[model samples]
Target: MDKRFIEEQDVIFNAKPDAVPYNYRISYKVAQVCLILAKSCWGKSGCLPIKLHMISFALCSKEAMDKLLIFTQSEYAEVPIVRFDPAVNSAVTFGIADGLIFQGQNGKYALTDKGRFFVSKIEKESTVLSAEKKDLSLLSTKLTDAKIKQLSDIWRNIYAED
Candidate 1:
């Protein structure tokens, strides 16, 4: 109705079909890292929490019935709920539960030896963890190839497997 509103609508209309804010890419990156770490440390000893179960179940449902979809008409649905939290939280929370990391004396979260073994592909120049290593390398390269070397050690330590 107003001049400012009209201009804003015009910009939205002309934007690319899949356009998203920069933060979306960054958050998506973080989500991927979390999933990778979780899969690396996967165990069948326990069940996933309700939120995770719902998201997983919904994601596999009929497209129109999928609550996890970006767009949904259900009254209980949130326009964009349940992404960064489950991925990131499960990574850290399960890491602790699985003895993959611990709180150091200095209050820093440090990876346990078991955790370090999982991400060891980034260091020690080994090819044993080929799949994981390749995935991590590609992801880091996408983020910034120059800095991946600098970050490799830290990534290996933080994302080691069970």
Candidate 2:
């Protein structure tokens, strides 16, 4: 976690699109992993708070979508960060229904054997996926439910302003 995020009332979710081509085999956006884990009749992503925050963070992160440039300032340096987007959550549900993501006991989402095989194949075949796997791994290691909730609050504040 960045110190600034903890110290400041405002937090930035720098959602820039990665250069990776879609992993056509998986055919889903990134944020749905949380849903894949949570909606399962099994175990959830640790708990409701963890599930929401983790998925929400993915939806707002650079790994999920590329940012578009808008010149709100004379220096052409303004960038928009998203707070929360429902579409991602819906997509996650769809992923679960479609069998791309599965939930076992406790609601923790595990990639189906298919998903695992697809990832393995993608890692071997796609440079972009390889990089994303790295990014996802790093992000996964660094979050807790509390931290995610903090970030989610910041996102909601921005969302409410609109």
lDDT of each: 0.36, 0.41
Model 2 per-residue lDDT tens digits across residues 123-145: 44444334445444444433344
Where model 2 places Cα greater than 4 Å from the true spot, the runs are 1-82, 104-108, 149-162
The residue-level lDDT of candidate 2 at 93 comes to: 63
Candidate 1 per-residue lDDT over residues 1-162, each given as its tens digit: 221101211211223357784223323322223334433223322223332333332333344223333232233333332333444455445556656555455433445555555344234445433443444443331222222233344446767775
Shift of residue 139 alpha carbon in model 2, Å = 1.9
In model 1, how large is the Cα lDDT of residue 111? 50
Model 2 poorest ten-residue lDDT run: 3-12
